[model samples]
Target: MYNKRFIIPGLVIFVLFVTFPLWFNAFSTASPVPKPELPPGGEKECVAPASEMRDRHMVLLNEWRDGVLRDGERDVITVGGKQYRKGLQMACMQCHTSKEKFCDTCHDYTSVNPFCWDCHLTPEEAALKKETH
Candidate 1:
């Protein structure tokens, strides 16, 4: 055990370095969970409830995309007395008009880049496209 003291200190230093992030994060106060801006005009209802949509909106969107594109189920759905066509730009964007205010808040906070933008243009983008063309 000639190098016992050096080995022990080195092991302790290595463990501290390895676990520093965990312990530091445990003590540091995290930023508040993002509250995405609600839709304007006091529109409170969605095709589904808020809690369900919050958790599963992506799943619902994927289903809608598949149904519309793959299965050719271009049907309108009625929820809460309002009829909505089965598409993102047709339905969701109608209410959640400002992608920055409504969608970007949560998406940015969660560090996600949803693939929705790959196909569907934002209102700003649409406007720019209109001007260009």
Candidate 2:
């Protein structure tokens, strides 16, 4: 009688441990189906004019600056919905560096001279001073 009781309890425990995991795995594998893409038969696509893009960019910049000042949140200035944190090299300076390719591309296309050096010193000058010391 003692042996039978122990065996029954052990068998119940073994079945529970083995079957529970398999049942969970089967349930988890039954994922929902994805939805279909929207039909492309719509109105003609409209490209934003250059002036409109510039105006929109200025509005976004103002909104970002306001959020930074008021809320102290860095989610204001986002690219592809990713927030950029404030830091010396991690902020806007990351892309607005003197020798970067992005600056040249805009300058070449717009024929506008970038007056970055008027306020900020060049990176080459900073490096030279560091080397001399």
Candidate 3:
């Protein structure tokens, strides 16, 4: 009778301590995919090939670097005064707010990391806080 009682409790304890953690870990395991590394010798691909879709991404990066637009303001960006809508509604912070989710999605697929983050803030205005403090 004593042997039977001890065997049942030992089996229950072993399942709880060992099997439960293994089951939980299988669902929580993350992918082993590595993040893209920075380029060398001054080679960078900020915009995709010169396509219509890529034009907006280029304009947005250039304008942000030049300090043309203020944060949270809707300034009409007209490339050559033609009123370019491609990049009009987009902001630097839109994708960069969640760097891992938004930026990593495309960057990981393409295997390139843009250097824009080196100098500018995601929201553009937030960089000012770092400077003042």
**Candidate with maximal lDDT:** 1
Residue 122, candidate 1: Cα error in Å is 1.4
TM-score for each candidate, following the candidate numbering: 0.77, 0.30, 0.32
**Lowest lDDT 10-residue stretch of candidate 1:** 35-44
Residue 64 in candidate 3 has what lDDT? 52
lDDT of 3 by residue, 1-133 (tens): 5798889999899888888967776889655565433322233332343354344665556665455445544455443333432231243233234455555666666676777667545543566677889
lDDT, candidate 2, residue 124? 55
Candidate 1 residue pairs in clash (backbone atoms < 3 Å): none
* Clashing pairs counted in every model: 0, 0, 0
- Those runs of model 1 whose alpha carbons end farther than 4 Å from true positions after fitting are 1-13, 20-32
lDDT of all predictions: 0.88, 0.50, 0.51
Hey, what RMSD does candidate 2 come out at? 22.0
Question: How do the residues 1-133 of candidate 2 rate in per-residue lDDT, one tens digit apiece?
Answer: 6799889999999998989978797777643333322213331211234467345634544555567668786642344444546422234344344433433454455566644545444555667878999
**Which of the two, 2 or 3, has more TM-score?**
3
